[model samples]
Target chain A: MTIGADLKQCLATIKSIEAGLSSLAINTNAEDEQRLYHEQMMVIEEIKQDLMKRIGEVEREEEQYKGF
Target chain B: MPEWIHIIYRGVLFLILLFLMTKLLGKKQISQLSFFEYISGITIGSIAAEVIMGLDNNIWHGIIGVAIFAVIPFFVEILSLHNKKIRDVVEGKGTVLIKDGKLLEDNLKKEKYTTDEILQLLRGKDVFQVNEVEYAVLEADGKLSVLLKKDNRPLTRKDIDLPSINEKEPHTIIMDGEMIDDKLASAGKNRAWLKQELDKQNVTIENVFLGQVDSSGQLTLDLYDDKIQVPKPQEKPLLLANMKKCQADLELFALATDSEKAKRLYAANARKLQESMDVLSPHLKG
Candidate 1:
């Protein structure tokens, strides 16, 4: 239960960060800064996807432990 | 007419005529002029000198002579523009002094340039060895143009097949403690933005001797007071370093965390950030 709660919190933080990076990418005037921010946002999106996958894995692992 | 009076009026008349004639002749540097233009220029000067000093018995003769010299060159230049043959005749063709690393003694002799002179011309172009020159032309302007052999040429970015970027020239935004409002517009920046940049450096516009904005939108300033050390603009490097630090923090968090799932999540994110950094290194470093 505790591990599931922690993973969910990490997901929320990652989502918040992803939004911040997206905002930065859109608002900046500098071409290079825009590229860097957009790239970073993409990287964070990948990490978010990976974390979501792991969240499901952790939850399933918890379910098995709960049954035992 | 008093001789002094004659000299004074002649000087004024010749001065006005000379100014007009110069305007008609166009602006070509003395060294860039052809053989005909060179002689005509000297003849015009001699005529003007004689007339201006009241030495020429007939002032009208000097005036007509100057007018003819200036007018002929003007017409010749126009004809040279429309006809290649006339241009070749007026400007003379460039003589090939060396070809395929071999001295063309016949061509050199035709141009009245000796082997020693050719060697000197090659040396002037920083080509020491005669064999290194693939081609050397004595241009019509008397300037030697030399092309080195492929093996002897200097390496450029294209030689190694590096990507080339068309970078815009840096705009001078400030000069001598005054804002160049016109140039600021070309740089795509406003006065308020410039003020903010100045504020960041803790320097006023009054103190800045020079300021330039590069293609990347970086502001660099040279202050009148050099003793006061203004901070170097390292925002790009600093931002890169901060991102790298954030990635390092994630790796550290992964190490310190006890939960296996959280550890894996942090490690994976850190690797993602590292990959992103690798791709962005060139732009950020630039």
Candidate 2:
């Protein structure tokens, strides 16, 4: 996918993760909600890593194609 | 055999036998402890002690006695699980201690719990005032479960009609003056961008005590041993210098007219600014 398409996917993932965390925070018992939030946050971080890697690959490809 | 060795062996054997018997009786046996089971438990321990001390020194006799005790409870549990009437007789039904905020005197009397004991249980749940309780159940395990009156329960964001916003967990990007590459990437950030943001706030990469990025793409920065001293209005201009830089970046990125390109750049720049603000805003004092 293009950089724009990749970024859009990343944004969507982040938004979905945020929704999961918010629902988890409100619905879980007090003793367990913190753990659930932390786990969801880890998933968000993984999405961000994937987005950055894809962005970097796109940039590298663009540079090579430009012969610079 | 030495006296101590014999004593230790007997004690260990007795404990093992007790555990095996308890396991065979199932979880409800301990949880509901019927009159028969309770008496049997005490009697079995006493009998086991006598057998251990060589009163029934024949190991086979001791084993036979234990087998009988264990087998009876084991069968009773299996029967109880299969038959509803037998289960009710064994485990008993849940008794209502408080119904519609009024104490159930008859139920309390049957359960042998005083009003003070009920009050103590409520207090354990952080419900000291009796008026706050709607329903209170005395569980089979001898614990109280309380449901609070609607007015007494704390108002949630939804109850107050506040707009529900998505909340995300913050990611730790730096700790103890070390950059966490994994966290940086997870926050949709890179080393070069982070370094630049840190530089803008007059904080070297090595001087950060803690740095985190929240889900909203906000960066929070703390300097090494830097106490959170709020900057005066006079210092606001200097402290908020990065905020302007962020706005300028957003404006420049906005010049890309193509919707797709503009959106990507917008997200990237927003994340960058967020990282800078996370580091700089505390000092800005607003």
Candidate 3:
């Protein structure tokens, strides 16, 4: 349950960060800043996906334990 | 079914369903997804996928499923638009984080924000110090809106009694040796005028890379071949001088060992020299 909650929080944080970065990219007056913001978002998204897979593995383990 | 045929059919179906749903829900639904809308999206996607793969099954089942999934969200969104209470319940409300330089503990707890999280958000906005913030709101869409203390805020030109900088967007007259006719017409210049301007600089249109007309009515030109024939003041000399002076100033905190500081000074000097060159380079005879 804790892992599930943490995973949800992580996903939410990732989405929020992505949204903020996207807005920054859109509103930034400088082209270089926009590019940096996009790059940061891509990195965050990769991290989010990895966390999601880890959470899935934890859940699978819990289910197997419960079956035993 | 052939792989190509299956792929093409699925693509067409996806497009049709996406179009129908987008039309039903407004454009805003794509960006702002409520919890119900989020679930509806997953459900609709699953139904669409089933329809695409369930070729052996009744085609009407897929059609019915798509229609049902699409119609429900369409009606809910429409109803929410008309009802404020329903909208608030679905979309959630904005929470206040700080008010009058005081952190709202209750609101912070409600939003699940630690002091560290708040600090992180402030730093993301370049706030650095929390005492400088007057008000901060955590918006419903999970975004921060910050208001800084009057004294801590950067003083604009207006605050210092200077005229406002012209904020008009610059127009591109020439891009990669090609003239933009629309921009030329808008700037009240013709092809003949452009040719005359190029002639004065002794530059052919083919040699030009980008030519922009700023709000000041100045034609800023960049050349394709950016080699400086004239011996201009080398930027490296000025950069070295500035670094030496900066290092001596104890308040500046600039160290001789700091390569980042040195690089920044070097780049600044290079940019200044580049700007000067951009202005005067055209006047210099080949």
Candidate 4:
């Protein structure tokens, strides 16, 4: 997949996972699972930021290729 | 029961059926055809031959066999167009045989291609040394696509710092003395304008065989009786606007990162851009 398409798909997957994470029933004893989800969210955010930067780079490259 | 009757019947039938089947399969060059398509062609040909020779057997059965083979590929081609995964599965994937001038033995084995064969392919591409290849891939169609290392690669205008002309698609304005009104309109011209341009050449539209206009609005005409003369440029113009934009982007990116490496690369690119502009300055001025 192209970087743009991969970013879009990644964001879609993250959104679904976030929704599922919110729906999970947690108790006081479920601190470990909640912590894992928190870490996962942080990683997802990092990936989102990285993908955005890469997408910008691709767009710049494309602009350079234009008019010929 | 006559042999000649069967020969004529089957000959005509085969001609029509094979043409239709090939058309259904779509246009693919011999080298571009996948292994699946190649095998399918063999099977279809065998069935066709059977239909031609099988005078004692049922002709409908042979016809049905050919039909099934053609129909499967047609649907497969359609499915490939829609779904990438199916396309990859159906057509197979391009395998990387060499990376960074290193031979990938596992991939070569997986592809079932020998080193001698790979070398032959590379030689065909005018690549003498394996060390000169940065990347070599065996494409899904069984053809090799090689990316040579920097020194082995062709020098472009960017390498030598030369300004480029923006490329344009040429539109056919006239064909065989007939004005292609749609093409002329698409190029933002009319018949009246075309006739006026023809008058410039001391010719009429009726005498002109073919006329085309480029994106730069340069009209080239081929007369029915006259040979057209187009001069070749002394130095090919490179589009420095593209290079300037990239250099500007790199500058911005370097400023944002504050990385010495990025800064150095940006400076190098900027220098190259300036050199290219300088090289073309004389020509542009003239």
Choose the strongest candidate by DockQ.
1
Clashes of 3: 0
* Model with the higher DockQ, candidate 2 or 4: 2
Docking class of 2: incorrect
Ranked candidates, highest lDDT first:
1, 4, 2, 3
Candidate 2 residue lDDT tens string, B1-286: 7767776887888889888778877675576456446656767876788777864387567768877766776777689879999878876667898889889899999999988888889999999888789999987657788999989888986887654444556789999899999988766678987787676566776777888765544457877756744222232344245345534444444554355764575566556545544443432333
Instruction: Please list, in the order the candidates appear, how each scores on TM-score for chain B only.
Output: 0.80, 0.51, 0.61, 0.71
TM-scores for all predictions: 0.72, 0.46, 0.51, 0.59
Measured against the true two-chain complex, the DockQ scores of the candidates, in the order shown, are 0.18, 0.04, 0.01, 0.01
Error of 1 at B21 (Å): 3.9
C-alpha lDDT of candidate 3 relative to the true structure = 0.63
Which residue runs of candidate 3 sit more than 4 Å off their true CA positions? A1-68, B15-30, B33-90, B206-209, B223-286
lDDT of each: 0.79, 0.64, 0.63, 0.65
Over the stretch B1-286, how does candidate 4's per-residue lDDT look in tens digits? 7898987898798889889878767786133467678778889889888778877767889889888888887788789989999988989989999999999999999889998999999999999899999999999878999999999889987788665544446799889998988998787677777777677667778777888875444467777875654332211123233334434554554465454754564455445445544543433332
Residue-wise C-alpha lDDT for candidate 3, range A1-68, written one tens digit per residue: 34355445545655564565565455444455456556756754554565455456556766742221
lDDT of 3 by residue, B22-118 (tens): 7777766576557666666677778777767766645568778777767876777788889999888877778889899989999999889999999
Q: What are the RMSD figures for all models against the true structure? A: 6.6, 14.2, 28.3, 21.3
